[model samples]
Structures are given as C-alpha cells and as structure tokens.
Target: MTAVSDRRPAAADPAVAGQAAEEDLRSLFGQSTAVYASLAGPSHVVHTANPAFLATIGEERARTGVPIAEMMPELADQGFLALLDQVYRTGEPYTGRDVRIVLSPGPHAREAFFDFTYEPRRDAGGDVTGIRVIGVETTQVKHAQRLMTEHRALLEQIARQAPLTEVLDGMARCIENLAPQEVLVSVLLADPDGRHLRHGAAPSLPDFYNQAIDGIATGEGVGSCGTAAHRRQPVIVTDIATDPFWADFRHLAEQAGLAACWSTPILAVDGGLLGTFAMYHRTPRIPQETDLALARVFAGTAALAIECHHSEQARQAAEARARAAHDELARAVRAERELRAEAEQRAAAAAELAARMRAAAAAQAAKPHPERCQLGGSPGCTAPAEVKIADSWGDSAWGCLAHAEEAIISVRSVFIASEELGGLAAYLDR
Candidate 1:
C-alpha cells in the first residue's frame, strides 16, 4: 500500500516537489471540514485518514489494517459501504452529493450531509489496489436550503393575506419541523398598548400552560417572553427550574415538560416592539449558533407579517369610511334636486294664474253691466251685486261684498274690476 506522500510523481527538483506535494495535500482537503480516508485491498482495510476523519470517528480507531466497515458500522446501512464496494470492483468512481446520514447512535446521533466521492486507486502494475474516499461536509448548506424553502412558503401565505392566526401557527410548525432537535415554538403578539403579550400561536404547548400566560405583562423579570419584549432583545433561560425570571411560572413550565426557553423580540423597522418568538426545549440545553440564527430569521419574518397585517386592516377601514362618505353625498344631491323641482313647479303655477286673471279682465271689459253677480256661479248671492269679476275659462259672475271676498279666496285671480268704488271696503261701507 502507498502512502499519500509516496503516491506523488518524483519531480526534477526535489525542493520544488516537496513544496508541490505539501500544496497538493492542502488543496485537496482545504475549505472542507469533512472526513477523508483511504482504504486498501478488496477487504477495504483502512490505510490512513486525515485529521478531520480521525477527529470525527475517534483517534483510537484511526489505525491501519482495520476494515472501514468495522470502524464506522453506521455507514453500512446508509449505502456508503455499497458505493465503496462498487468503486473498488468496477474501477469507476462514485460521487454522492448532499447525501444525508445519521452518524452515531442514541444521544450522540447527528444529522450530517456529504458531497463525497469514492475513487479506485491503481498500483504501478495497472491492477486496482485500494479506494480513496474524499468528501466535503454539506450539512449547513442542506439546513439552509430547507430553511429558505419553508421561509418562502410562509412569506407567500402572508402576501396572499392569509389569516394572521393561520400564518403564525404555520410559522411555528415550520420551525418545529426544521429544528435539529425537538423544540416547541410559540409566538406571542403584543397588545395595542404594548403592556401585555397575547398568545398568538403555540401548537405544541399544553392548553393550560398557554392560558396561564396568555396576557403576561411586559416588564423586567416578568418571564422569558415578557422580559424579551420589555428590553427589545433576546432572553435565554437555559434552565427554567433555576432561573429567577421563571420563579413565578416555573411550576407551570415544569408541568408542561418545558425545561429551557429562548425568547427573541420581534421588532418593527421603526424599533417598535411587535411580538416575541420563543423556542422551548424539553430538556435543559444551551443554544447553538444554528438555534440563534433560526430565531433571528423567523423573528424578522414575524415582524414583516405583523406589519403587513396592520397595513391591510388600516386600508380596509379607510375604504369603509370612504364608501360611507360617498353614500352621504349621494343622499344630499337627491335632496337638493327634489327641492329645486318643487320650487320650479310652484313658479309655473303662479305664471299660469296671472295669465288667467288677465283674460278674465278682458272678458269683463267686453260686457256692459256683467249681470247676475259676477262672482256667483252655482248658487245665487243673497247680498246685492257690487263687484264684477271674470276668468279666462269663459265664466263670469256678479257678487256682493261678502260673496266677492269668498270668490277671491277660492278662484285663481278674481278681484273687483271697479276703481271708482275703492274696492271691497267701499262696497261694505255702502
């Protein structure tokens, strides 16, 4: 079996060759924090491994003549052993990109991804000797891709104006699914006054626990979420049982099987507090970088959703007021139109009455004495005739002072025609 140092071709200048060899080794494994190993023979016995490989699988197991399968038995079921077998038998290389594997077992189990290749190695005699395993870790890339997909879906829901409760609940579920470990996610919205935090979403939490903290006030030492909102920052309670902030709620939290809590305040762009995004753990555990990053990402998303919701509500309310104003204007216009129509009708009637009175006057001028009480038509007037009145409808009558007064009141423009008697007062005096 050949070591990595001996496999290189000799250079004309030994000094240059040494430097080139060192550079080649560094280049092959640089920019990667993944395990790399070389296996020799048909049995796939471990020949050598890089520092990363030894650190991952354990330094005690980093020895030659040990079969790769014996060292990392977990890879046997993950199809890595089959890939190595295929490469060794066919003299062809096999590459697996973004392949997920669960390394170790029980409490030590971790989710990992690899961009790896298994290539056949050849001896000087042209026969296949061993297989070379080169790989780069892609766990972070895998997690990021998943995170973006879920986050984009949430944004789309918000864009379409989904119910606020539905959006918040879905976001909480998304984080729960994407977390590396079991986590209970809760989103608490701030009341309009900013003094109290209201439960927005907490699917995994117990109903009793949620009710107990529904309207928790935002103040110093109020609780993890309350304190986070009050300070407008993140609050981490690694162990709820021992933390002073949890003294009031510790019994409830313990009953709910929640041991750790990390709360981050969701803030608007103007620095106003919107709500809190919290992650609860069943066991007491410190947060990793990934956990904090997840909190920040979802916290920003929550802020966007809340702002959009508030804007939509405001716009709807404004539209309703505008509609009411328009209706009022329409009513006012109709009333004005009715009043103008009534005034025009009254003016037309007055003009028609004036023309009738002029015709009556001309008719009276054509008659000599205007016999039979000029103001009487159906019944004879008991009072003597003293005034002559006529109308354009070819009707004329004579009447006394009392009858003449009645005629003027009932008819459209009938009055005394004589100017010498000084009208009705003179007739009455006489």
Candidate 2:
C-alpha cells in the first residue's frame, strides 16, 4: 500500500518575476560600472551625474550646471553631443551598443567603449523637457576580447616555431597598438648566465635608444629592463627622470622622450630568468590595474615564446651535430674500403714482380753479377761497378753507385748484397 501527498511548488507570478529580472538588469548596468546623467533644456546642460559618470570623465571636472560638450570638449568631435541633441529634439529614445569613444585627446589620450541609451524626458504637458542618459562602459570587456584574440595568435606563432625576433617584434607592436595611452613596447632577452640583458625587440623605440641599451648589465639600479631581469620580478619606474634606476640611462631616456618604464621579467617554467618585457610611456604616470595586468599576461606569453624558441634552436643544433657525425662515419667507412682495395692491388703487383725476378734468375744463373753498370738500359754506364743489388728470388746485378741505389728503390724486396760497400752516412761524414 502506498500513500501520495498532493503537494507541489507554486508557479512564479509572471509580473513579479519580470520585475525581479528588470531590477537585476538595472543593478548590473546602472548602479555598477555604468554612467547615469540628467540633462536640462534643448541646449543639453548637465543637470546631474552619478559618481560613475564623474569617474568615467574625470573626477577633477566633476562640476555640474555646464554643457557636457564643454566639460568634455573632445566628445564633440566624437559625435556623442550630436546624438544627444538629436534625442532632445526628436524626443525619441536612442540606444547604442559597444560604441567606441576616446575619453581624452593628445599623446596621453585614453580610449573606451560604451553601451548607452538617451531617453527624452517629458513634461506634464507631454512636451519633451530634457534627456536622461544611461551608459555602461564596455571598454574592459571589449579590450579583453581583443587581447584574447591577439594572445591566441601569439601562442599559435610559438607552437608553429616562429623566429624569436619576429614573434617579439610583433608582440611589441601589438601592445603599442592596444594600450589605452601612448606607449612604446620593448623586449630585452637575458644572456645565458643572466649577467646581462640584450635588446630583443623595440619596434617603436628609436634606433639610438635601442642600441644604447643593448647588452645592458643585469643588476640593481640598471634601468627598468635590466633591473627586472636581475631581480627576476617586475620593476616599476613610474618616473624615469626621478628614479635612481635610470640615473645612468637618464640621458638616453630623455633623448628618446621616455618618461616612465615598467618592466616585467619573463621567466622560464623552472623560474629561471629568461628576459624582460617593458612598457615605456611618453608621459610620467603610475600604472593602473589594467596596465599591470597587461604586463603580467604578456610577460607570460613572452616566456612561452622564448622557451619554445630555445627548444627549437637546441633541436636544430642537435640535428646538425647528428648529421655531421653520420657524414664523418660514412667517410671513414669509404676510406677503409679504398685502403683495403689498394692493399690488395699492391699484393698482386708484388707477386708479379717476384715471378719476373724468378724467371730472370733461371735464365742468367751463372752471370748474376755484371762488370760495368749492368743495370743500365739502352746506353751503358761507364762508371766502374760499385755495389751489387739482389732480390728475394735469387736474381742479382752489379752496377755503379747511382744505378745500384736506383735499382734498390724501384724494385720491391731488392736489397744490398755487396761484399764491399760504403754507407751513405759514412760518405756524408767524410
């Protein structure tokens, strides 16, 4: 027997569920990391703004009761002011998603993106009065996606074993392009012993500046990259002009228009110092969270790239050595084979020479020694016979000193068989 209880969870009310979802959306894009503003009249004077809005522009320019275009004059050129005016005139709500914006101008200008809406506020008479502005800054998210794309590309380059110089140079250029403010990127590779840092890549830096810092010693107070490599950590030089680390390199830095340098040491998986990754700024400024984050991310990427390169180089070197050793061994085997053939040829020649000597001895057994240079051919040597030469097959000849020595050298196994002879050593002594 089984008993069943008739109990079930109640269904959520459509209106109440909808309201809860709306509140969460508002909290996400309105109260947190979003800009809210109220404008007055058709002229679009700034009536009020949330703290996020003030922070988004600049805290120093937090004063209200003024036109936003006047407060942020750069935005006028960027077309946001025109969009606001159109909303005020038409009384129609306008929305934009992931719109690119430049927050400031000049060399140190910052770039941003925003998803925003401009809703026309109505009066009691049903006439448009002002505009309500709500915007969520999407700069970080957009930049993060872009960074991931670029970082993945770099990893692919490493996996494919791209040249180290090409990888590093491309990385420097990519960072310079993506940084929020004007910055130059530089990479310095550490020497094998970690005693010095050599210029790896500096696409935006001046040639003179790059050359001057090439092979800089890795030690304390030796500029940003060198010091970072020496310590195997990040080194922040917010003001190159004031930092003691840049004391020696101050002149070079000034010539290159560099005011700040933040460097991170690219380390191997085993925690050994590999090289340095640096961001150079035109204006003196402290690093923000994003700036430090970028350094850490790219520093790791640089380490991966450098380690891959070293491994590839080592592999190539090993292959070359193996090829050389194989070639040498092959040559040695060929040489041994050739020597064996030559020795066999010499043995055959020796056997033939011995047979010729034996036949000549059988024919002239009684006259083994001749009187006047018997070894001469065609013309007879007039010199008196001086020595006798003989071969192993019982053949002998008597001849002048010159013919005797010549016969002994030309005929294998032929030796002096003279009863009276003066050695060359005794003759030279006399």
Candidate 3:
C-alpha cells in the first residue's frame, strides 16, 4: 500500500483512537524489557517507571513521587546521580555506553551494565521540566563476551599440553568466576576400567571434602560424579540432601557446604568415559540453561586435555618397551657371536694335536724307546716311561703314568698300543 493510503482515516472512530492510545501506552510503559523512567524537577523526583526499570532497581523499592537518589541510593556514590542532574540542569542529553553499576547493597549486590540515556524533558517554552531515563541492560552481552575470552584461554592451555591438573584447576576457577550465581566446580577422572572415579580438581572445595570423595567407586547411587561417570551421561542432583544417589555422601556434602550438584560425564571421541565435570551449589537449586551450556563447553575441554594426557602416556610406554626389546636383541646377538668364535677355536686346537702326534710317531721309529718321557713338555720328565699310548694315526709315545693319562684325555683318538714290562698292563695293574 502507498504511504497516503496507510495514513489514518480522515474520520477515525473514537473506539479506534482509544485502542491506539492504549497500545501506545503499553509500548512506552512495558511490552518491552528496556528500562524507562521519568523524573520531574532538578531533585529528579521519579514521576513514573516501567516494569523493566522497577525490576532492575528491584521491585520492592518500586515507587513514584520520590527522588531517584532515594529509590536507588547505591547509584549516588557511583556518579550516576550527578549525570542525571547535569542533564536536567543544562537540558543537554547525556548518553552512557556500557555503564556499570552495582544493582544492590552488600552480599546481595550484583553487577549490571547498560547502554542508557538521560534526556531533558522541556516545556512549550523550551525550559527543562524533567529528565527521561531510557536504558537497555547489556549485562548478559558483557558476560557472554567474557565467557568467550575465558573459554579461548582454556583451549589454548589444553592445546599447549599443560599439566592436566593445571588445566582442570584453571577451568574450574573460570566457571566459578563467570557464573552469575555462586558455583563450586569439581572434576573427577574415571579409571581405565570405568569402575572408579578419582578426584581430578576442585579448587574451591574444602580439602576435607576432596579427600573424602577421592577414589569413590562408580555405580548406581554413588553420588553425582560417580553415577554420572558410571552411566556416561549427565546426572543432575538439584538437592544432594534428598537425592538417593548422595545417600552415602550426604555428611561430606553437608560439611562441604554443598546443597546441590549437577554432573556431566566427560567422554572420549569414541564414546569412552573419561571423567565427570560437576557444578556444586550452596543452596538446593536446579541449573539454568546458561549453567548447563557452560558445563558442556568446559566438559568438552576437560575431555580434550585428558585424552591428550592418556595418549602421551601410551606413547611413552611404547617407547620404553621398544628400547627394552632392542637391548635384549643386541645382547642375544653378542652371545651368539662369542659361542661361534669359541667353537672355531676348539676345532683349530684339535687339528694341531693330530699333526703333532703324526710327527711324534715318525720320530719314535728311529728309537723304539726314549730315555725321558716323550709325552712330557720341554722340561722333560725324570720319571721312567711307564705306558705306551698310541693314536688312531699310528703315532705312539712312552711316558710316565701321569703323562700317559694326560695324553689320553687331551687326544680322544689315543689308546693303549701294547702291554710290555712297562706298558699299558702296568697302567691297569697299578
């Protein structure tokens, strides 16, 4: 339709005008989550506020006809009151981008951010009357940016092969700090057999609590971490005191100041159980969507670190085994070479003895008897020849009984030639 046709009818119905007015009011006062408030006079007395404005400042303090400083006393010290005053006095609009403020006081306080404007509302004569505040909370967006930054740091740490404990501990602290609500993170690693859970890291947990839960068995009703590890899935125990899975661990949990735990099992790419990533709460509480999302993101990170550690361990073990086998094989080869060398030496000695015996026999033919023991060494034996020993080569020798026996043993082919007055018979008789 053309712009002229889309214009309001020349004669509009009264009911239609009232309905349009009501819709406009709804859009201004609510129907949108942006914080809106109107303050009158230099004192900045709150004239009206939208639901979003009341929610941000707290609904309990919601009221009109009161100064903004009194309703949000915390803002006075944060420089926001001065900004509003300047806008109203000078009639110059002021805008703040990513302005941070603490929403409440003391322990109940939470940090929030906003992109906001303080604009002067003027009369027909152009004199400033009041200030109109329009703001949109950027708290969630700010948190999301922080989350991505922290998550990136964690991924870098894992990629660099940092100590598993360091990576896990850093991740736990990151979640605890980033979460909108208070959270204590615990990581438990699963044994190879998937039958037990060993404490991995829990920076914020009490030492006693960590000790008590270390080495817990994985099975049904074995608390959040164990059960999650056993089942290889997420187990959300909104209240540990009442959950059957925590019956065996109730006292420890209570002492540790933990009222709730939500655990997600960390798994390998092959779907094998690696460990459990858990978030503990101080009060009985169910996890929000953001909480679960944070768990999943970090749980995957934990798995990556663990798998890398395991792979490195396996590789080192394999290298050790290979080195051992190489050493053993080298030793065997050396022993075999020594044995072969020894056998060759024995054969050479035997051949030399056979040649000597043949020469000795030829010399004996010249004189049937010798004055000294022919079998003796260069230092001839004074003892009489007592035995005649011959080898299969027909080489014979006359020697004392001791020398004869020595010849018999050293030359296996040698035997008694004949028995004389002092021959082989003497050896038998003696």
Candidate 4:
C-alpha cells in the first residue's frame, strides 16, 4: 500500500485504485499466448485459467474451483502436485525449464516440454494466498537440440574411421531411440558398380527380411530403397501393400510387419551413389518433416563413412602389393648371390685340380728315357725301361726288356736316373 497509494491519482480511493490495478494486471496477462493459471488454497484448486491454459489442459476440464489434482489425475502421479506443494509451503518460486511431460494415453499420447514457473501469490496481509502458474512450451526446441547432439556424435564416429557396420548399426539405434514414434532403420550399401545394394546394417529389421533383400538391384519399381538409389533421390512408399513400387515385395514386407518405407539415397561429394538409408514403420504412415530431416542428416554421414572405408581399403591393397614386390626382389637378390658364390667355388676347385695335374706332368717330363710303352697299372706291358732308375731310398734297379720297367712302374716316385746315358742302348740291345 505504500507505493500503491503514492502512485494513485487524486480523488481515487485506495480500494478503487487497487481494483483498477488488478484489472490492469489481468488485462496484461490475458492477452499473452503463454499458458497461465491461478489456484487458491493449500489444496491448489483451479480458480481461473486463461485461453492458453485451457487449451493446454483440455477445455472440458478447465472449470473453476476444481482441485488441480482431481481435474488432471495424470499430473498428480507425474510429481506436478508435489512441486506445487513445495512452492506453497516454502513461498519460493519453482521454475523448470524444459520439463518433460507425457499427456493422454494410447496412440494419442504425446511427449511435450514446458518452461514453467510456480510462483506463490501474497494477500493484503502478506500471507501466502495461492499459486500462479505461467509456462511456455518448448518441446520442439528440446527435440531440435537432441537431434543436433546425436547428429554430431554420428559425424564424429564417421570422422574417426569407425567400422561401417558399427557406425551404421549405432546410427540406426540412435535414430530409433531418438525418434518421437517407433521406427526401424536400415542402411544398404551400393556395390562398386552401383548396380546392386548389399545389406550394410539393419539392427532392428528381421533377419529373414534382411537376407531376402540382400544384393537387391537398383532399378525403378524395385521398392523404396532400390528406386531411391536408382533415381539418386528420396522415395516414400506410405503403404507397402498398395504401392506399385512395392508390388514384388508386398507379401514379404507384410510378413516382416513393416507397412511403410521411406528411403533417401546417400550420395558422395561427386554425386556418385554411396548407398541408401531407409526408415520402416509398423503402420502405413507418411514421413514427417523431422523424419525427412533426420534421414538427410544420417544419409550424408553414411556417405562419408562409406567413402572413407573405400579409401582405406584401397590404401591397404596398395600397401600389400608393394610389400609383396619388395619381398620378391629381396628373394631374387639372395638367389643371385648364392649362384655366384657356387660358381666361384666350382672354378676354384677346377683351378686347383688343373695345377696338380700340370705339376705331375712337369716332374715326369724333367727326366727322359728311350721310347717305351707307358702302360703301368692292371694293363700289363713287358717293355724295358730304356735307362737305369732308382728310388728315393737309394735302391737301384736294372732290367732288359721288362724287369726294369716293372720296378719303375710299381715303385712310388721312382724314375730314370739323369746320369744313366748308356743304359738305354744296352737295354734295347738286350
């Protein structure tokens, strides 16, 4: 009342001024799109609700003087009533930014968020009177933030050269977990020739379905993924049973419990086909804007991962070839060295043998005798030694026609004497 009374116009009573102030405050808050509600008493009974508040909590239940807990029983179990009690008891405002809440049940259940404040209202005596609820929904913003964080993690995995299956499988699982609704993810890699798609990863898809579609060719009317790869764009088949493109696979898709598929082609930077990313749904449903956005993001990531994997493979192959060539060259050098060494050894042996033979011939030639048959060993000859001879022991031997030849041939190193000049003619005459 101190500040309020000072600001009041002349002739306006305190009660009238206070009423006018309350009306002004109501007018200011009424036009706001933000959800606002006022509750009275410790039980937190709904006393007033703006259009935004009524819209947020279905209009039929927005009656005045109804307890908040009785009107929305779902909130009581979700800790909302406890938050109100804490604010009422402590007289302290409780603010929750991006608080998650699930509304309704069954297929219509929606996940939402609110940036809300529970402020304690005061009376004329400064006692806690009631609670005021003011909030702005931020579910979309929260979801966007989550999408960015998940998408960045996927890129980091790809940049670090994670295995294709691990990356793709992890990506599929992430999308399935982050998606607002249930979805199944599949990534099929294009063959090098771009004619066929091989199953790269499909953690949520049935094994039989995965095996049946492995190595599927890229062509028109070949189902959503195949057509998207062929066209190099996105293809959406809202209902597999009725879509002409899924005619061939309708029965198989039904068996796998998939009613719809939306696929986007993953293209390299040069516009070449890398692979296809697909999202499957249980009931026939069209893709939302968020769904398409998610597909585009992961599709780009898939392209990067596949291209990097291909580059790594090519590098490993080249390295293997280079190593094999190096090994072959080393082996050839070793073999050449061994051959040269063997030839050198053979040449040395031959030279030593030749030297021994030449020395023997020289010693035999240094002392000459009259011409006679030289046959000595087993092939016996009765020719005479045409000169006298002696052994190293100084034993002299002589013969006519045959005995002298036998002694020289049988004795080791025995030969004709250099000074026996008349011996040859005497032996020949005998």
lDDT of each residue in 153-266, candidate 1, tens digit only: 999999999988999999999999888788999999999889999999999999999999999999989889999999998999999999999989999998999999999999
Candidate that scores best on lDDT? 3
The predicted structure with the larger TM-score, 1 or 3, is 3
Please report how far candidate 1 places residue 250 from its true position, in Å.
1.3
**Deviation (Å) of 185 in candidate 2:** 1.4
Residue pairs clashing, model 4: 384-401, 386-424
Deviation in Å, model 2, residue 240 alpha carbon: 2.1
lDDT of 3 at 23: 50
lDDT of 3 by residue, 1-430 (tens): 6455665553366556644643554477685789888788989999877889988888788899999889889998999999988888788999999998988887668889999999887764688888888899999999999889998998898788888999999999999988877899999999899888889999999999988888899888889888888888899999998899998899989988999999999999999999999999999998888888989999998999999999988998999999999999999999999988988998898677656654545544454766668877898898888777776455677899999988777766675655332222211212
lDDT (0 to 1) per candidate: 0.82, 0.83, 0.84, 0.80
lDDT of 3 at 314: 93
Q: Per-residue lDDT for 69-188 in model 2, tens only?
A: 778888888898899889988888999999999886675478899999998877545688788788889998998888888889999998998899999998998898888778899999
Q: When superposed on Cα atoms, how far off is each prediction in RMSD?
A: 8.3, 8.5, 6.6, 10.1
TM-score for each predicted model, relative to the true structure: 0.69, 0.81, 0.78, 0.71
RMSD in angstroms between candidate 4 and the native structure over all alpha carbons? 10.1
Residue 327 in model 1: lDDT: 96
What is the C-alpha lDDT profile of model 4 across 116-202, one tens digit per residue? Answer: 999997765667778988899887798888878887888888788888798889989988988888899999999999999999999
